[model samples]
Target: MQLGIDQDQADANSRITAIRAAVLLTRSMELWRRERLDPETVLINLAVIAITSERLMRGGLDPKHNSLDVYLPLEKLQGCNVASIAAATGLNRETVRRRVKSLTSAGSLIRTASGDLALPPDKVQERSAQELVRRQLEALVRFANESLRDGVLMLSDEKG
Candidate 1:
């Protein structure tokens, strides 16, 4: 006896498998970065604040229409409090407080008027952040183009 599979169904399954692998690879990179930043995890947590604060400020704005100049105003951005960060990251409140204090001292994070934590506007434009973003974008583009060429992903008819 032999099992039979249709070509269309097999193609769809291959695409799904490829996407799942890509997702795992992306998450592994994030975990690796977190581990490489510090064994204590303080730097990684601080980095999360620096990255997420920008996204939170951007809110429902289209990327093309959003300007860093408009969103980089530290005062205009909402800060993430220790409790919220703790809840989001699954870290204890004390750990969050301690790490946040260290980050503040290191100039990576600042204390807001409401005693919440935020990334400094200057920090947002730091060379390290810029380089990291550049490298990540390149990696993503390479992955996407390779996937398209391999027929594991499809692009719609829309062009930007």
Candidate 2:
């Protein structure tokens, strides 16, 4: 039986991409679960999106406002943990706390604690560029740690 082109493509390209994607997705979920990311964390991600979009717009390009960005900074900043959420979203502390709480109760956010909130996994996945940037940061941190370790080893070798 001859399957459709999608089936054929799935059978072929899927082998490579699917496993990688699944593994990456699992890792992301694990991070989210273990870290219990707050609304501020999600807001930080939105801020990055906003900054990127602003840069794009300034570079002679048309950039659309991310819905999350618009909501967090403009509307949803009131229900968060004030200082922390404000620091994350660049909004006023009182505003962030209020808005974050409302969003959390409405299921627009994943509320881990009175002081913490995060965008749902679906929303986070929808904004996968943020995740990619985070992965890049993780890689950089790992590289830096390795370099520091190697430097220490070299120093010890020289001493001994």
Model 1, C-alpha of 142: deviation from truth (Å):
2.3
Candidate 2, poorest ten consecutive residues by summed lDDT: 151-160
Q: How many backbone clashes does candidate 2 have?
A: 16
User: lDDT value for candidate 1?
Assistant: 0.61
Clash number by candidate, in order:
0, 16
Error of 2 at 120 (Å): 1.1
lDDT of each: 0.61, 0.48
Candidate 1 local lDDT, 1-160, one digit each (tens): 2223344644866866467568756654664374355533544455455555665556654565354343354555555777777767678889878887887898867877776677776766666666665666776666666555555556555443
Q: List TM-score per model, in order.
A: 0.61, 0.29
Off by over 4 Å in 1: 1-36, 39-71, 158-160
Collision pairs in model 1: none
